[model samples]
Target: MSGGILSPLDRAIVRATQEGLPLVERPYHAVAEAVGTTPEEVMARMERLLAAGVIRRIGLVPNHYALGYGFNGMTVWDVADEDIAEAGLLVGNLDFVSHCYHRPRHLPHWPYSLFAMIHAKEKAAADALVASIAQLLGPLSRGHLVLFSSRILKKTGLRL
Candidate 1:
């Protein structure tokens, strides 16, 4: 069985995990040094967190826009409730899909529930990708595309 709320140490670990460890070759070791724990302990706690579903994943964010792939879009889908998960899984696996999630749809006016992002080297490429996704989804899916014009804000890391 799992315990109650997170302990202070565990909270610290979570925060550290989000803010990221030092960028050195031995990043975990640096984190351990800052958190006053051993690298092995940090690794063990991270594993436990994963097992407990406290954290889904640890990943690095690449600056795709800076790499000249500035054309990005959020493609929203109005999919059957039962097929949302299946469609999400299928779309999420696409190489161009950077993020995917489900959101509540407002009736009468809005009907999109599943959202996925497609990033490409140009707007035409992104548009074609969205068209391909729509064709792949076929008659069961309905949606629209919203292209990102500018990056107004950006943030990395999280606070526990």
Candidate 2:
């Protein structure tokens, strides 16, 4: 779970994965060479990491803005405490919703606990999606959209 407990090779793999493997015909081989390991070894270690839950997933993150999805909104919902988990699952299942999670509510000032992300072609489309979610969650549920004004500052793998 922690880098300190991982083997040197595993740590190297983690670092490489975070920084991103080289873009080449044989990406694994390129990564292995950088980390002083063989392609087979890198593949094996990755498999082990996945099996052990050290790595949840390995995949690509496309640029939504480049794909014509210019509106990126972080929608936070104020669902009842007892319904947070169910509501999170429901919201996460939506095709437009990219990420959903639960966080502690900030009372008096802020009361949202569940958060979901939506990327759309325009702000109106994003607002429509939020409206649909409101209809599904009812009056107790309240949300606000935070539109991203600039590019994402950070996007990378976990350090460990």
CA deviation > 4 Å runs, candidate 1: 156-158
Candidate 1, poorest ten consecutive residues by summed lDDT: 151-160
RMSD of 2: 2.8
TM-score of 1: 0.84
Report clash pairs, candidate 1. none
Per-residue C-alpha lDDT of model 2 across residues 21-134, encoded as one tens digit per residue: 677999899889989999999999988888888877877787888799888888888789988878888888998788989989878878888888888898788789988888
Query: How do the predictions measure up, each by TM-score?
Result: 0.84, 0.82
Cα deviation of 58 in candidate 1 (Å)? 1.0
lDDT of 1 by residue, 1-160 (tens): 1584777777778877786656799988988887899999888888888788787777777677788888877888899898998888888888879899999989988889889888888888888899888887886596665757577246554466
lDDT score of residue 111 within candidate 2: 85
What CA root-mean-square deviation does each model show from the true structure? 2.4, 2.8
Q: Highest lDDT: which candidate? A: 2
